[model samples]
Target: MKNRWIALYVENQVGVLAKVSGLFSAKSYNLQTLTVGTTEREDVSRMTISVKADDTTFEQIKKQLNAMVEVIKVIDLTTMPIHMKEILFAKVFNLNNEGKTEAFQIAEVFDQGGNVKIVDIGVDSVLFQCTLTERKNNELITLLKSRFKKIEVTRGGAVAVESISSSCR
Candidate 1:
């Protein structure tokens, strides 16, 4: 099935995530990614989800999601102008004093965008935090998976939508 990126603006309230997730689960939608956060307006939260669905089926999903009370708006940003970024935190273990070279090499992988920051480092563990587009972040993971023991990884689903022409950058 084709994939779609959808952005949802909703009233910031408890159970909002559950309500939207329920709709997708009920429809058997294959959710690939999701990200939610409070917007500039405290009362509004933005949600971005990536899912696989055919064109017609995707339309129905928008309809169903809109049925929920908290949902204020839903838009597919893939076709419109949009920018998306993903945050990744990874931990590497089994390091020693001699492994500094290898660790530096790994850090470079995430530093190109200058988003990767060394959050912490210890005798046997290295923690790195990074933010980039989903594609870029995944590529970095694939490159480092064999070199480091990626003990943990957490990603916000997706935050996407067409950019306003005046604000495009």
Candidate 2:
């Protein structure tokens, strides 16, 4: 199975998010990530969703989503040029000065024209915040888990938009 991306424009009304997400749950589709936000039109909202499925399953998912009343439109983005990013925060605990410095250095290495920064530092803890592609965020999490004994991670679902320039993730 491969990952597929989709963008849904839905009505911005009560129970819309629940109904949309419930469809996935009812169909037993493993939703990898889902992010929703209001658009320029207050009456509409856009949702960016990712799922792992084979071609047939992905097509079925699209059909099912399109049949939903609240879903105004569904755009398959798997092969399209788009830009995407996910928010990740990693907080390392029980750190010493050396460890804190190491965390800062690691963040710098990952920054490379991206948004990765040591947002917070305490006596024994440091927090790294990053806005990057989902895959990159996973790599950063893996690295932090390996280096730090005590760590906390929080991740936001990815948000994506059609690219006007070059394709990006």
Candidate 3:
């Protein structure tokens, strides 16, 4: 099985998200994560989608995606190693000293200093933001240890491009 990070440079238009997601669903492609937003160019949007599929099936998906009229570019951006990261926002219940201590520990471990933002908080819960490598994030989950009641966890898809090598320049 091959895990792919595909980037689409597409024209921004109606139903684009739905159409793209539908295509993935129809083709039975498993999308592990995704991020989409308008690019610097006003008329275009960039989408980063991480999907898991076999090599042959991935090739077919690539061909079909490239054939779409709305797609100006379709890049299978997985092979090249690059800076890949995901941001996760987690909400944990903050009830007592135990809760506060555990939540602080969790946040300290996950937070990349000020880069991660704490968006909101309630009387019983604390929301925290974290940016780190996937491996660190995966390890962070183990620290939860059932002490804090996790309210929610959200993450953005990995965004990366081909790393500049000495030979490339």
Task: Note each model's CA RMSD in angstroms.
Answer: 2.3, 1.1, 3.1
Question: What is the per-residue lDDT of model 1 for residues 84-156, given as tens digits with 9 covering 90 to 100?
Answer: 7777887777877666567677778568668887688887888778877788778777766766654567776
Which candidate has the highest TM-score of all? 2
* Residue 113 of model 1, lDDT score: 60
Off by over 4 Å in 2: none
Residue-level lDDT for 136 in candidate 1:
76
Output the better candidate (1/3) by lDDT.
1
Q: lDDT values of the candidates?
A: 0.79, 0.93, 0.75
Global lDDT of model 1 = 0.79
- Order of candidate numbers by TM-score, starting with the best: 2, 1, 3
Residues forming the 10-long window of minimal summed lDDT in candidate 3: 160-169
Better of 1 and 2 by lDDT: 2
**Clashing residue pairs, backbone N/CA/C < 3 A, model 2:** none
lDDT of 3 by residue, 1-169 (tens): 8677888998899988788888889988888888888989989999888888888888988898888888899987777556667777777764666686667766765677564555676777777777776667666655654665555677776766556773210
Worst 10 residues of 2 by lDDT: 160-169
